[model samples]
Target: MNIVFVMIPIAILFVIIAGVVFFWAIRSEQFEDLDRQGSNILFDEDLPAHQPNKHTDHDPQP
Candidate 1:
């Protein structure tokens, strides 16, 4: 079909754009520390449940 001529160029342009974005991500350090970022959410840096609250549940009359 004549439409193939149009679609082939569009597909090539998409591939080129994807490659550029991939390279940019690599150069910008976007792929680094992927595991650490995921693990940060899994592990709690500070445990508020174990820490005592500054204010008590009941307040004394002023």
Candidate 2:
């Protein structure tokens, strides 16, 4: 009962802060390249054969 009184105000404050941050990101062009990023992930070209297997970051196991 008493806890709800404390929690309600905190939750409202958090919602206001999150809304402000989202608006700031939109104004700063943070979402401008969303389409480019998705397309880039699907369209990466194959690397050269001589380029020592840069695909996996781990060492090759025997």
Candidate 3:
């Protein structure tokens, strides 16, 4: 029961720290690229499939 005194102040401090960091990030434009990130996944890509070379059928030692 006495520990609540210590925990309550700690929790309040945590909330204040989190709010400050959030406001700092917002003021610095950290969320500006959020819309671009959502749209980037909709574009088509020309990537190729990865595969190993098939050299088992051809004999180079014989």
Candidate 4:
């Protein structure tokens, strides 16, 4: 029917636009290092633990 004629071109246009955006992302390196960002929060830097001050160190026995 008349609706089919309108719908077909709209669908084709949508596909073309999606393809262009996908290619643009690839060329721009948008997908590079995807895992690094996702896992960055999971692990922390291997910093040395803070030690207690000698003056504040206390041993108590009653």
Candidate 5:
């Protein structure tokens, strides 16, 4: 049909673009830190507690 002529070229163009993007990602360092982010969530960090009103007489009324 007439649609085949248009659809075929569009599909080919999309495939080529996708391949270019995939290769670009590989060439860049996008996939370098694959495990560091995932492992960070599993461990807990030691953080200081929040201190309130160290040098002021106006205490917070709640």
Candidate 6:
């Protein structure tokens, strides 16, 4: 019975904090581009690795 007094206020505080954060996120447009990040992985460009010069036969050796 004594724990209820403490737990109730804590729970209410947590709920209020969560609501504030949720509203802030909506106002900041945090969820506007939800699919852009996921789709970018599929369409990203991959760069080729660097290769050493292969025409060394005609050049003088060091």
Among the numbered candidates, top TM-score falls to 6
lDDT values, one for every candidate: 0.88, 0.88, 0.86, 0.90, 0.88, 0.91
Summarize candidate 6's per-residue lDDT along 1-62 as a digit string, tens digits.
99999999999999999999999999999999999999999887895666657785356779
- Per-residue CA lDDT of model 4 for 15-52, tens digit only, reads 99999999999999999989998898788677668877
RMSD of 5: 5.6
Clashing residue pairs in candidate 3 (N, C-alpha, C atoms within 3 angstroms): none
Q: For candidate 1, lDDT tens digit of each residue in 8-60?
A: 99999999999999999999999987899888888966756765456865556
Q: What is the C-alpha RMSD of each candidate to the true structure, in Å?
A: 5.9, 6.6, 4.8, 7.9, 5.6, 7.0
Clashes of 4: 0
TM-scores vs. true structure, each candidate: 0.66, 0.62, 0.62, 0.63, 0.60, 0.66
Query: Local error of candidate 1 at 11, Å?
Result: 0.3
lDDT tens digits, residues 1-62, model 3?
99999999999999999999999999999987898878777874666665656775555765
Off by over 4 Å in 1: 44-62
**What tens-digit string does per-residue lDDT give for candidate 2 at 16-42?**
999999999999999988889888878
**Which is better, 3 or 4, measured by lDDT?**
4
Q: What is the alpha-carbon lDDT of model 6 when measured against the actual structure?
A: 0.91
Record all residue pairs in model 6 with backbone atoms less than 3 Å apart, i.e. clashing: none
> Candidate 6: TM-score?
0.66
Off by over 4 Å in 6: 46-62
Those runs of model 3 whose alpha carbons end farther than 4 Å from true positions after fitting are 42-49, 53-62
Local lDDT at 15 for model 1: 100
Q: If both were scored by lDDT, which would come out higher, candidate 2 or candidate 3?
A: 2
How many Å off is the CA of 25 in candidate 1?
Answer: 0.2
